[model samples]
Target: MFKQIVFLKRNRIRKKSKLVKQVLLLSFDFTSLFYTLLVIGYFVIAIVMEGNIRNNIQDKIISIEAYTVEQFWVILTAIPIIYIIRSFNQPGVIFSTAEYTLTFLPNTLQQVWRVVAIERWIKSGITYLIGGIIIYILSPTSASIVLLYIFILIGLNVLMTLPEWKLFQQHLWLKIVVLISLILINLVNLYLKSSFLSILFIAILFLINVLLLPRTFQQIDWKKVTAASDFKIWNMVMISYVTKIKYRKERQYSIWQRLSFWKKPFLYKKSVGYNRLWHLYFEKNIGVCLKLIGALFLLLFLILFIKEELFFLAIAFTIHSSSTVAASLFNDRLRTDLVQMLPWDLTLFKQTILKWIYSTSALLLLPIIMFIFRDLSVWTLIHVLAMIFSFLFLMPIKIEKVFKKFDNKASDFKWTEIFCYILILLIIISNIYLEFLIGVCLMMGIIPILKKAEK
Candidate 1:
């Protein structure tokens, strides 16, 4: 059975289609030896640093540090529960018939317990090792205690994963009820300042999940599982999935048109039809716009309610939006082969791109305005205007310059990508300085240069 499992995993990797192979190859190449070196170097540095800290730090300071370490471990444990639940909804990267066969196995409870046990052992062992090292480094006096706590915590985390797994197998309403109950439990624990109890509760839930797993497995069909096709059904159930498919189709169509030399020039002319630029833009990109809007709203909602630390969450959202906008511009640049073929004058093409950038910038600004401002004020207005102007004017020029420089390369990253990096840094710093005017002026300067580049 073990050999069969191993063979299945190996076949999944080996028999991947050309596109999948390409994606895996690209990811591997991009990461390369740096990943191995990075892991080794991090462990070495951590060990050395820990030794130095243990030798030098005072006892009182070490005690304080240990509390921080414990808190960090608790947060890390909680975060991955959400991630594991999220991963189940994602399609499996590795194909496996064994997963199907598991449903048919006799002694389902024993088999399920074995799977859960092995998973917990591996997970808990790693967590214990890391926590042990941390405790030894920071508070060697509590090393053994920390190791025991870590074991408990790891067991708890594994237990928590089980209930969440079972909850995910339910109807949408039932799943929502489970989620709400869990959230209420967490909230009450937080209100009472009960971290250890929270961990314990999570652990209890995992035990329940284990109890339920065999039944869940029994309910699943083994023989017909491999033949199942439900992407369409899933799409119908998940609005987000539907939106994603629409976005993907539109993106693919745009990419195809942009890659076709014969069709490019004529299609470029069609882009400006009826002088109805807004309609054209929406027709081509509303799916992407809606996606961004959804993301922004979701992020703002999380920042307001979900995360305890609002400041970092706010900054993260801003940075995420800015980076996404910059990346989209880069993608647009990659489609420049079609742009070059456009019958429209080069200057006109530049103008149209500038207009598109402005429109997108406006759309992006709506989220920031809604999230960051409590009421309408001159300062808020100024900040909003400055941000919009900067993104509209400066972002396009920077994108154009970067794209021109890296036009020959098909890779995701190039030296020219640094322009967007610098732009993000500037935006962050400008926000810090509260110098809205500086940003506005900087953006204004880019227009003339962009025009000159068009020529």
Candidate 2:
């Protein structure tokens, strides 16, 4: 049955890829995106602790040697606790409509359980594998430590998620007990401060859960499975999609309407062209800006206090985020009749200025962290300037004329911006003498071009 599903998936993917190629061949560059992700993966795996970098949690200036023995386990210990908390919010034994139908086939209940368990283990294993690789990168010791962590994580993923099963989920006490047991075990391990004892406790906990799964699986609630997966609603949506019956474009504002800031401040008493543009920017993007700021705060804490190695993740994040927000600044505003009724040249100029403001503002944290942690050198200075120029370049020079035509998808600068991103990221990572000179000249040239653009 699994083999049949796999074959179907492969055939479906082939057709989808053909359709995507026919549609997006001119608008996208798969190669540039692949290389960009490769660069990020390289940084994530290659990070190492060089010396006594300042850690915000341990000390203002703690040695990596000390942290290796003491605080390294702290990060590892929190992984299971995070999983426990997150599992509570996850859906009950989730199965798609397709998978739900498979249960009615001529298969025993044990066989069904076997297939679901195997598929889920594969999916969850991929997730845990990535997590383990990240922890390995962050570990100051040998790879054996991370390997044990990964093994424990695989078992714990099943154990922790068991609470979401019908037997445990309906009876709140069982769920609470499981949550407390896992949390207490980890907390005790922290107090004992012995790696051997921690591993022993985790192994015992994993065994208990493994023994309990058979009994729990016997009480499987098939109804809850489909309900959790929104089986009926999904079928309706598919039917609507196929029959060309479009859903309503409007979204309810009940939740957001209550937030004081969701209601815009008094920007202008009267609605002018600039006011309209400002309104449009906030109307569409303010929620994203606010959410991003909140996420960045958490990321800032992790990078500063938890692991300075995660600074590499921050750079990759900022590069992609700054480019995305900058490029999208004018997409919705200029693509429609939004700017048509307003003054064309002046509105274009205003939107460009707003792009510069928002993009530069989003990236202020990266440079700050860079200068604080890194040495105050000329290359560091050049790197920061290069990033800013590349961000500015992401907005095509010919954007003034785009989106004015009937064919909205005629704009094909997506790959050009992607190539610019790849070039800038490569230059930033390989900040050598030759690259530094090239970056300087590139920025110098871009400065005039941007000035001409503004004028």
Candidate 3:
């Protein structure tokens, strides 16, 4: 049985390794792959032994920092703290549903635990082993730091079975007390600035969890255990043979949502057609509108306050909003059958949206941006703004025109292939120049592709 378990585990590891190998070989050219590997290897080596990690790296990798030993302790401490919290919610071991089933039927928790421990070690053993060796080298006098790393890894694994004991689950006060006690240990260590004391407390915490695992195995919540491994669907299908599992409760709508004007129609005339239709969908799911608005507001905030991130945010929002608008229009087009039949020219819609975006919103937005940032260029913002609106205006028309070609021929997903060309063209054009010249260049690039695809 143990050999069988090991064989199954080995196969999973092999499949993952094979997929990664294929992706690396196929996706990138040799020169690009070679350079990327060199850069990654340099950083990995730098991180592993930079001045023996007593001090943080001082480098040009802006915003990201490599923490010193003292700071890393806090970050490392978060692991045990996080697992303790997780143990409350999930006491399920990291076995798959099939593995869980097999282990439950034939093996004692201790016996199965040893197998799992071996698997866990196989997965992360070398990584922590290297870490332990480094800690030992750094503070050879403090031998307990090596044990600290070991116990931390073990405790993380053990705490997943936390709720198998009432000391954590049924007793809410006890759990809180345990959490507070652990936190206080950190506090005392911080107050004293004692590395030895912190290491001692952390190791002791993990040791306790390691001891608790087998004792509490009989009290394991099978429902939560199965749920953790996502076995509920299987349980539902085989309801007679397997026990009924309680899944997560359905989402409850807030009182404000129930009472609010979600279902109320937009105050627009019937002639609005697609405009009214889109608004109706947005109204029903107003979160979409609110979220888009929130993102726009966040962009404004980032520009004003976090100026360093403004360019990155602009690029992100441009790409994100472009995809979102394209997706929304595509989904909404499918929803409105009448709108699809109507002669809906994107040129008019583009002009209308651009009018509001370029004139009204820009007038209000650019002034505030200009006031706060005198040195910063508004060119990037204007460029991204134009690109986002271009995608919104172009891609649907591109898709529509592609589909029209298939009206005569046998309908196939050749339009999807055609749209890829249009998308790539727009992206390329937008990156170089930000103007209406995009339309002319776009038509020049697209007409030939359309003709070839139509053939």
**Each model's total of backbone clashes:** 1, 0, 0
* lDDT (CA) per prediction: 0.49, 0.54, 0.50
Q: Give each prediction's root-mean-square deviation over alpha carbons.
A: 13.6, 16.3, 16.1
Cα-based lDDT at residue 394, candidate 1: 45
Ranking by lDDT: 2, 3, 1
Q: Tens digits of per-residue lDDT for model 1 on 1-455?
A: 45544565466446545435554565466566678989999999998777874466557656665675656434534544463444334211111244455446553534543553464457567867886786576655566666666766665555554454444344444544554455445544444556676567656666677687666545432222222212311223233433344311111233223333525334435446412333344446657765766576557545645542352235445544655565465446445544434443433444555565455444344435544553456654654554444444445554455445444542223332343344445544554465744654564455445454543
Best by TM-score: 1
Lowest lDDT 10-residue stretch of candidate 3: 57-66
Off by over 4 Å in 3: 21-26, 30-32, 35-79, 88-92, 104-110, 121-125, 134-189, 192-215, 230-455
Best by lDDT: 2
**Cα TM-score of candidate 3:** 0.36
Question: Better model by TM-score, 1 or 2?
Answer: 1
Put the candidates in TM-score order, highest first: 1, 2, 3
Residue 196 of candidate 1: its Cα lDDT?
72
TM-scores for all candidates: the values are 0.40, 0.37, 0.36
Model 3 Cα RMSD, 1 decimal: 16.1
